[model samples]
Target: MASRRTISSEKGFIEKGDATAFSPAALEKSNIAPAVPPGVIFKLLAFTFAMVVFPIGSYFATVNTIFRGKMSNSTFAGATAAFIANVVLIGYVIVAMKEDQSERLEAEEEAKKSK
Candidate 1:
């Protein structure tokens, strides 16, 4: 994956792309605001919830199948759990990135004032 570069100043965050540059406030507004539309965030949250719940449901289903001599092994349950875990992990990463951006902006503001 290509790494991103951002410069946060007193006013706001700067957005930079590969070989691209943006002034302080220009970057902050674009980067800090939610990328997805308002409704989309809820939709994404709902989808992620489904991802976790479906795997849990599958685990029980797999168990039932095993009891009835249907599923020959535990692979299905394990795979489902792994998929759900990955999605949730990605969700956490997104949150962490957002928080980090906020913190960086705050620090930059303080530095500007001190100077």
Candidate 2:
């Protein structure tokens, strides 16, 4: 039987002896803040949830009620779901563009005031 060598946790094969482990303290010392705003994050999450829920929900709801559980009518249900998803995507893009434009205008006003 071959002998097994035990490696030290502090200095593994890939880790150097002088290297230190990552810690939150290093981040606390930095002056940087998160680049993304909370509102933007919330909007993105909401849109993502709608994209997932609305399409599947519409597909099932339509298939059951409107189509009366007919297999042939599933294609129409699928198309409706796809159209809803596309609408959600377009809405997100429009919101993002408007938000970007507003931010740009605010920045321009700040620059004018600073001059």
Candidate 3:
């Protein structure tokens, strides 16, 4: 097995005894932020839960054909509910994106007016 890599930064992007040091000018020009917003993280987690739940629920819902020849109503209902909830969550993501676009456009318009 390979040894674990250790990272140490002193002055922005600079590592002790490492030649791949970034200059202040380079650091100033770079921009980075959280890979995903906290809200998005939660949304993703919820979607993932739905993804896992839906299949199991579906399998249970169709257990009559896949397994024992008896259908479970509760499993079918649960699967339907999860499907609907995920649909709503997906819609919310789309709406949020549209709202963000609107807000960005408004900011640009205001900037132009000021100029």
Most lDDT-accurate candidate: 2
Clashes of 2: 0
What are the root-mean-square deviations of the candidates from the true structure over C-alphas? 16.6, 5.7, 8.3
| Predicted structure 3: lDDT | 0.68
Which is the leading candidate under TM-score?
2
Which residues of candidate 3, in runs, are more than 4 Å off? 1-21, 46-79
Better of 1 and 2 by lDDT: 2
lDDT tens string, model 2, 1-115? 9997876665664566432334477656766767998999999999999999999999998987898756688898999899999999999999999999999999999999999
- The CA lDDT at 97 in model 3 is 90
lDDT (0-100) at residue 15 of candidate 2?
Answer: 61
Worst ten-residue run, lDDT, model 1?
Answer: 10-19
| Candidate 2 ranges with C-alpha deviation above 4 Å | 1-29, 69-71
lDDT for model 1 comes to 0.67
**How far in Å is the alpha carbon of 38 misplaced in model 1?**
27
lDDT score of residue 8 within candidate 1: 58
Which window of ten consecutive residues has the lowest lDDT sum in model 3? 7-16
What candidate 1 gets wrong by more than 4 Å, as runs, is: 1-58, 61-70, 113-115
Candidate 2 yields a Cα-based lDDT of: 0.87
| Residue-by-residue lDDT tens digits, candidate 1, 34-87 | 676676577568767766786787677766664446465566567756777777
